[model samples]
Target: MVMLDADPAGYVYRVLDGPLPEPSRGGLIRLVGVFEKVLPAISDEYASKYYTQARDLAALATEIEAMRDE
Candidate 1:
């Protein structure tokens, strides 16, 4: 699992390079939903910055999935 403040992109790349199961991999969408729920609830600027980073990480994960399907 990638920590909220850690290098999420790196974690994604590593997971992609390994023998991850299909069902577990499909959970990325749910992960994005988690971030989506947290984003709007954030009122502090500092926390919001992390929320944006989480959003980017979620996007990166989705993009990887799209590229894999191509």
Candidate 2:
């Protein structure tokens, strides 16, 4: 989840280091669902940004699944 500081006039978000943290099973499911809806309407200008976010979410999911195999 993206978080921001509580400032009425300014915003500060939390940045993760290295890789995106894996969401819980339920959260991942929700992310996948949101992506399904968002991908179709993504325009060319923002495609690269959204594409990277989508890829990161997918990668996080994969990493989580792999950890379960251990």
Candidate 3:
């Protein structure tokens, strides 16, 4: 997984290279786009449930960045 530092400007675009079915590729792209758009709106509870660490916001951001980079 690729990890990136978080910034106020948010995530930058990441190019992905590989063979993937059209639907799967599209779904991944859609998920990243949606997350990028809604991330700032995510509540603490939601982040906590998925991230599981109280002080791991940085790690969570890294995971999201990696997803975008995938």
| Candidate number of the best TM-score | 1
**For candidate 3, lDDT tens digit of each residue in 1-70?**
1121222113222222334345644544554454455555657876634433322443343456456567
| Global lDDT of each candidate | 0.67, 0.43, 0.41
lDDT, candidate 2, 1-70, per-residue tens: 2211121011101122222245444444455565556656656766646554654555455455556658
Each prediction's TM-score against the native?
0.68, 0.42, 0.37
Best by lDDT: 1
> CA lDDT of 48 in candidate 3?
35
Per-structure clash totals for the candidates: 0, 0, 0
Model 3 is weakest, by summed lDDT over 10 consecutive residues, at 1-10
Residue 24, candidate 2: Cα error in Å is 1.8
Output the TM-score of candidate 3: 0.37
Descending-lDDT candidate ranking: 1, 2, 3
Off by over 4 Å in 1: 1-11, 15-20
lDDT of 1 by residue, 1-70 (tens): 2455454554476557863357745666666777777778879998899768767876777777667767
